[model samples]
Target: EAGVVQSPRYKIIEKKQPVAFWCNPISGHNTLYWYLQNLGQGPELLIRYENEEAVDDSQLPKDRFSAERLKGVDSTLKIQPAELGDSAVYLCASSLRTSVAGELFFGEGSRLTVL
Candidate 1:
């Protein structure tokens, strides 16, 4: 199967503008994920989707960031009114099952630069 795929490998936007990233997880994977990685930091879980439902999103910043896994096949992460502090790499990952049972496959992240 193909690995997770993410688009717009890089983006630059002014503060307060809107930006979006898209992802397509490996076929047959039931778990889709979004992670945020800031400079010099390890990846932080932002959200996890089990099929079409968002099963875990405690770390997601609801006010400015929103995500959806459409039909459990593709996903999108959007940041509206972006802030300079939001500049970071947005990673899309997937697994055959839950984290405990399967290894995660990560895409080449979409890097955002908010000026």
Candidate 2:
């Protein structure tokens, strides 16, 4: 079985430009998550989806950032008029089952650089 998949592994753009990242989670995995990691910082949860419902998105910036899960399978994250502070790695992860000791599978990630 395939792990999560993310597109545009790397992206470089000038400030104020628009950028979008995509993710395809593992099949039959009802839980999907999008995380952002800045340099020297741990991944912070941007959003979490249980099926088609966005269960958690407290950290997501609605002003210039948006995300969606289609049919609870694939997902997309977009940032418009990106700022220099927006440079980070967008990670997608999925888990078939969650337990105290279980692990989550992560994609290669989308690394964005705002110049």
- Cα lDDT computed for each candidate against the true fold: 0.95, 0.91
Compared with the true structure, model 1 gives a TM-score of: 0.97
**Model 2 Cα shift for residue 114 (angstroms):** 0.5
Cα-based lDDT at residue 114, candidate 1: 97
TM-score of model 2 (CA atoms): 0.93
RMSD to the true structure for each prediction, in A, is 1.0, 1.6
Candidate 2 residues lying further than 4 Å off, grouped into runs, are: 97-102
Candidate 2, residues 1-115, lDDT tens digits: the string is 8889999999999999999999999898888899999989999999988888888899999999999997889999999989999999999998765434256789999999999
Which pairs of residues have clashing backbones in candidate 2?
A: none
Residue 16 C-alpha lDDT in model 2: 97
Once superposed on the true structure, which residue ranges of model 1 sit more than 4 Å away at CA? none
- Tell me the deviation in Å of residue 100 in model 2: 7.5
Q: Model 1 scores what on Cα lDDT?
A: 0.95
